[model samples]
Target chain A: MTGDGVLAQALRYLNDPLSWTAPGGILDLTGQHLVMSVLAALLAAAVALPLGAWLGHAGRGAAVVVALSNTSRALPTLAVILLLATAGLFGDTATVLAAALFAVPVLLVGAYEGVRGADPAARDAARGLGMPGGRVLWQVELPLAVPLLAAGVRTAVVQVVATVPLAALAGGGGLGHVIAFGMGTQRYGQVLAGGLLVAALCLVVDGLLALAQRFAVPRPLRARAAATAAR
Target chain B: MPGNPWFSLEWVRANADVLATRSWQHLLLTLEAVAIAAAVAVPLALLVGRRRRAAGAVVGTASVLYTVPSLALFAVLAPLLGIGRTPVLVGLVVYALLVILRQTLAGLQSVDPAALDAARGLGYGPAQVTLRVQLPAALPAVVSGLRLATVTTVALVTVGVVVGYGGLGQLMFEGFRNNFHRAEITTATLACLLMALVLDTLLWAAGRAATPWLRGRADGGRRAGHGQPARASVRAGTGTDLGADGRGEAA
Candidate 1:
């Protein structure tokens, strides 16, 4: 096909109203993608955050933390998804689990490092102020750790969004269906459009998370960063 | 029991040859992708390292490339590159660039300014200073990046099964496609994970051997306190820190 034809076909597929209107249309698929991605990220954060933070605060299980994080990073996510789907977990569940598994390492590492890396003087001052250990953790450590936590969450979310398309391979539904369908029928236009949408969604989410990370920084730290930038 | 297709000992015994071939394919694919990615990422990072001003743009582009979905990228590349090793190789190479590039840039930039000054004072020219001092200092950091990229690429190479070029991934896909055969799927999964661990360990060993000074430095910096060991460039304490990123403060 000519370059112009390829571009025209992709644009036509994207601009078509029908692509946005159905039970399985682009809009619907996008919603599915978002739901799967968000749920998986939330699940990962739920498990990773408390455990990682506690481990970091206790200063124990450093080996376990390192091993777990590395294992998660090294897991072949698509393989896991296929295995899970074939294992009878079924549809979106397998996808979500795969995405969650993919997300856990980054979030876990972030939380662990964020808490462990906190300024000891500030932590000590909190203890000296007669604050309970739990109170110190909540009021002092968590706030300071927010920026790293946000960064981790941002990375996790983008990864999950990108990964959810793999679900289509397992007969799970999402934007990947478009690409899969296009592939089956040699409809390069649909494939291009679907891929672009997934990429665009990732970038949009990345931008939002960057903004959130900016806001998550403590005021003093933000001011310091600003000062440093100015210098 | 032999009646069970999914998890039969017989099935695994029968598929030994399949496993070996697929594992070899996976290894070759991962090695090629990482090699290409390093070739591209190092020079680009070196350029950015020297310029400093271009670091943001280079890293940003790498990030965007990383954000592209692996499966989608395969689909897009398949029509152009044709379905086989080429598309998968391209996709894996793309995925690797971000981590490797970031680490290289961070490593090169992290070279001590005082050392650079000393080199200059000692009559070293710009190229000499970069070649003699900066590159040596940055080696550990760059190796750390390579370790991360290598592990990640191993994982990603499996996804190329979608385009019919996955190494062990293809075996796993076949297991799934052919009626969820338990033994086939389970064996393939184990093999994939095992390969990942083995490869990661190999790279880890290489990093250790390459940076023997890290251990000595760790001993020297022990008394300087909690964070100082990590900040000491080459140290056992800094190994994990280096594995991720260069910033000692951020972890």
Candidate 2:
């Protein structure tokens, strides 16, 4: 069968070894994508987690958390990147900064909700057992909050990974570069191939994170979550 | 001479027509995508309601679709749809589906079982029960979903510049392409944020107006007992709770 269709052509592009190993090829772009996603996620987690967890443990700032999460949904990632680029940051720096901003609210919300939603009985029992505030947060609350924390990171990472492709629009490097280059040159096949690569990367990252989320929870907590889900 | 300011009134005046056109296109695209998504997702949600396996499968697929980056979705569709409003519109609908579907399902599931039973005992057919009891009760969650979807679509519409239909996105990108025109980029970006805020507020108001019972409790039931107070708080918190839920599944 002739291979003139977009999918076939895209597959052909994917099949080419040069596409993987050449300078600025798929592998190179994929690495850039992963690096941006990971760095952005780490930056977001570093800032959002401690603040969110502290606020949640204190049982304060519920309204702030709620409002922040709501407003975050309205911030466009593309606009964010362009705004940053215009502000003098360029290349991967702007991409990561924009992505971290995009990733922050979910992580913060997740951290807050996870810690706050921890079992009150468990927290009280730990308190009653003469545990200090810091100890309670570390030993009891943090462990219980693991599932939601993991889920939050997973969401943030997937979002970052997905969004890093937009860096191409700002003249940054990533899998999006291939797609952007193709679009500019009218090479539909390359665009499709790049799109496929990005999509595949997102799925793989998400799946791995889902597994991590499952394994991060204590067995008892996992069972309880399953039971609640079932009910 | 000093550089151009980030918010130059001159630039706004110079490009007033294009800015207005782009902003209108942005709003129109968001509305079309969200309207189509709601029409499809509501029916799909109702059909899959209370069916554990089917809901899982349908939502699972939608979530996978959601995981695909907006830019990639546009790129993939461009080859098939030939790069225009259609691909961008299709991408927006796909992005909105998971959010709307999951919330719609959650809303349907949240309908009090007792209410359903009462409707049944009153000789209401399944259709009537769904239309009269379930839909009304589930309105809050559905509306929350719409709010999230609309805001998200407003943002995603900016990404449509890739396919040449990104509404305000075109302005933002153009601002960048034009030697990083600070005024143009800042203006378009702020416009998107403003549009999203306005749309979200409008939807929240509409949700409240649609659910008069919720307003009645919040406004007039200040001393309406412990259970009433708790329930009122839960209803008030439903939007954010559902927002978190949608984002969780979206990833």
Candidate 3:
């Protein structure tokens, strides 16, 4: 199609939110994907954060956990969705599994890094004060690592937002529906608009994550400043 | 359990040439994506480094790019780019952004301030200082970014299988679709892990090589080595950067 046609198609998509959200219309690209993504990220955080924290705090197991998570991350996400999809987990179940698997590395690593990188002296001081392992972790380690944990969760959420669209092919719903519709028809504009929206959403999520990080974490080391200073 | 019958030694040996072809194609696909990623990320980072505020913008944009769920992202682009390697590379490049930007910024950030001043005091222009002083300092970070990008690219390369490439993920996709089960899935999984691990180690070493600082090299040996360091050069690192970005310190 000509440029005008493409533009018109794209505009049509943007203007027609109803087309995307009208109850199973256009693959349920509305809040369904976001809900799925957030839930997936939370699931990832739930498992990875605690496990990562344990591994990180234990001091000796950090490498093992990191290695395992790192390896798990190698599992192609699309493959994960496909595998889960065929397992009859599309819709709710697929999103959950995909998010859980995808989120693990982020939360695990972030939590581990957050806690491990905390001021050792602080940990020492906490221990000296007779804090039990549970208390130290809950009160000290987790708090110190809150920002990192949040960062990891933010990453997982963003990933899930981007990823759950694949569920459309499996009968799950979200922005991927827009993409699939466009693809089925060889419509570039639809794809572009759909992709653009997804990217924009991800960017928004990333920006929010940055905001969360700034508040959750202490004063961030300004890399720009550091870069200049280092030079 | 990890060993599946479909990927039996017999099947592999019988089709060793075919497997090799797939391996090579996969390797080239990954490297092409990574090479393009390095090319784009490093220079962009340098530009960003020159203007600190913009670097954040670049990285911010990149992190968002990282989150585009691979297959769906590819499917979205399939109409425009026409699948195969094009969209995959596009996706991979976007993924590389956070890594490249962060490392570029990191490399610039990691530079020794005193050295920059010395270069400037010697009447060096902006160009000279960046080339002779700042770039060298940022090398380690650039290297680190490249290293991360390499591993990420390796992992994400499998996404290409969705659009009809025969990478390891293709095997997994086929296995899953045809009901070859975990045995078949295990091959793809192991292949991915092996590829990621091997590449990670190589790049980890390369990152050290890239970043003289990471290696704690002394004297002139540090600056001249590993080119400009990927920290200064590579702008993309992803899980496919796995959505790692400068989560900002404000929170």
> Which candidate has the top score in lDDT?
2
Candidate structures ordered by lDDT, highest first = 2, 1, 3
Using TM-score, give the best candidate's number. Answer: 2
lDDT over C-alpha atoms for residue A156 of model 3: 60
**Could you tell me which 10 consecutive residues in candidate 2 chain A have the lowest summed lDDT?**
A222-231
Off by over 4 Å in 2: A1-4, A227-231, B219-251
How would you class the docking of model 3?
A: acceptable
Clashing pairs in 2: B160-B166, B161-B166
Model 3: per-residue Cα lDDT over A143-173, one tens digit each: 7776656666666666666667766555567
Docking band of candidate 2? medium
Model-by-model DockQ, in order: 0.46, 0.55, 0.32
Report the candidate with higher TM-score, 2 versus 3.
2
Poorest lDDT segment (10 consecutive residues) of candidate 1 chain A: A222-231
lDDT of 2: 0.80
Q: Pairing residues by index, what is the TM-score of model 3?
A: 0.77
Question: lDDT (0-100) at residue B75 of candidate 2?
Answer: 87
